[model samples]
Target: MRVSGLILPWAFLLATALFAVGLYWALWVAPPDFRQGDGARIMFVHVPAAALSIGVYAVMAAASVTALIWRHPVSDLTAKSCAPVGAAFTLIALITGSIWGKPMWGAWWVWDARLTAELILLFFYLGYMALWNAVEDQTTAARAAAILCCVGSVSALLSKYSVNFWNTLHQPASLSVDKAEHVHDAFYLPLLVMMGAFYAYFMAFLLLGVRKEIRARRIRNLRGALAREAGA
Candidate 1:
């Protein structure tokens, strides 16, 4: 808690700085694409949100695995905290993708493989959170949620690889480590900065959420102890 408290402010500051620079570069500094014109600028926000939507789920799934297998003290809390944030990112990705698609694809949406898979991923996130809320017992809820997270991880895999496995209107990755030349530096650098900002925002939000969960659990435990003493 102490370490997280100290680090949280810096994380927010870093995210803020990166977001300011990234948005400036993406919106103003980067040249309009010859092909898509200014419509392509939306990719700067859309791409990062799309990537993080899956990436955050991966983090939750890993934490869920640890919570289930090793019973790590903070693992379940970490996974629980990740769900809402991941869901928000998924929603952003969907909305932004739709916005970008309408102009480029000439429709608001299509049943593209990647888009369908991403929608399923959003459902998984909602189900995971719903399970946590439905169960009364914390331990039982944690176990059930962890299992769901693991099972739903298949959606994340599908979301990532659907473009590769099937024909789709959605384009391939805008940036790749091996194929750096595919995107011009003007666009690529700003995209990278935006991704960094999103990641930093995730970390800051995750820490804040986990801390809140820990405090809530402590309060519940204390109240339980008080009730037991009164009954005795």
Candidate 2:
């Protein structure tokens, strides 16, 4: 908590700075796509949000695995904290993708493979969080939620590979590890900056969320103890 308190402000500041630079670069500095024109600018927001939606779920799944196997004290909290954040990112990705899609695809949405997979991922996040609330015992809730998260890992995988596995309206990744020349410098650099800003924002939000979960757990424990004492 103490360490997070010190780092949170810096994380927020960094995210703010990067967002300002990234938006300016993406909106003004980068050339409008000959094909999409200014509409392409939406990718500046959509791409990062889409990436983080999957990335954050991956983090939650990893934490869930750790919590289930090792029973690490903070691992469950970390997974729980990631749920709403991941869901928010997924929602942003969906909305932005639809907005970008309208101009390109002639519709606000389609049942494309990648889009369907992403929607499923959002459902997984919702179900995982719902499982936590449905169970009364904290231990049971954590175990169930962890299992759900691990099982939901398949959705994340599908989301990443759906474009490759099937023909879809959604385009393949703009950047790639194997492909050196994916996008031009102007678009690539600003996209990178935006991704960094989103990551920094995630870190700040995650830290704050974990701290809140810890405090809530502590209060629950105290209340349980008080009830036991009263019963005795």
Candidate 3:
């Protein structure tokens, strides 16, 4: 755990550097879309935000499984810490998509399947966080939250496939490793860089959040023990 103390600072610095350069490359270095023009610039942010929102949930679901099966002390904390970050990225995805949509789709939002499913994903995040805090008992709360996280994890798959399942205002994925990338090199390169930066940011912050939760738990236990001793 002491290694985490040393690791977080360097991780934060690396994330910052990557983001700074990635954003610059995305905005300035990458050429605009041949069709959408500068409006396509929003893709650099929207795609990563959307991906990480589901990606973080995937991490949470894995932690949830560990917490349920192995009963690891930190698993619940890891899952709990991920909700807000996932929610924030979900929000960024929604808002950026809306902004990009206004220019392309002539509207800020539509009731299309992918958009609707993403909205549902937001509720799942909010619900998960609320569920954890609403309970007073830590152990009970963690178990409850873990179950909810596991069940709701399906929404991530639904969100990802929604675009593929229906013909909607949203377009299909532009990049795929198995298939030829739809984007040109000018745009694809920067998008790849940005995605890497976004993932780095998530990992760095996630570790920091988990570390804070661990510290907070220890402090609470210490204070409770002191009170019990004084009473005795």
- Most accurate candidate by lDDT: 1
* 1-232: candidate 2 lDDT, tens digit per residue: 8998999999999999999999889988999988888898999999999999999999999999999999999999999999999999999999999999998999999999999999999999999999999999999999999999999999999998998999888998987775574677778889999999999989989999999999999999999999999999
Best of the two (1, 3) by TM-score: 1
Question: Per-residue lDDT for 167 in model 3?
Answer: 84
RMSD versus native structure for model 1? 0.9
Score residue 70 of candidate 1 by CA lDDT: 100
Error of 3 at 198 (Å): 0.9
- Whole-model lDDT, candidate 1? 0.94
List candidate 3 stretches off by more than 4 Å. Answer: none
The models' CA-based lDDT, in order, is 0.94, 0.94, 0.89
TM-scores, all candidates, are 0.98, 0.96, 0.96
Which residue segments of model 1 deviate by more than 4 Å? none
Scored by TM-score, the top model is: 1
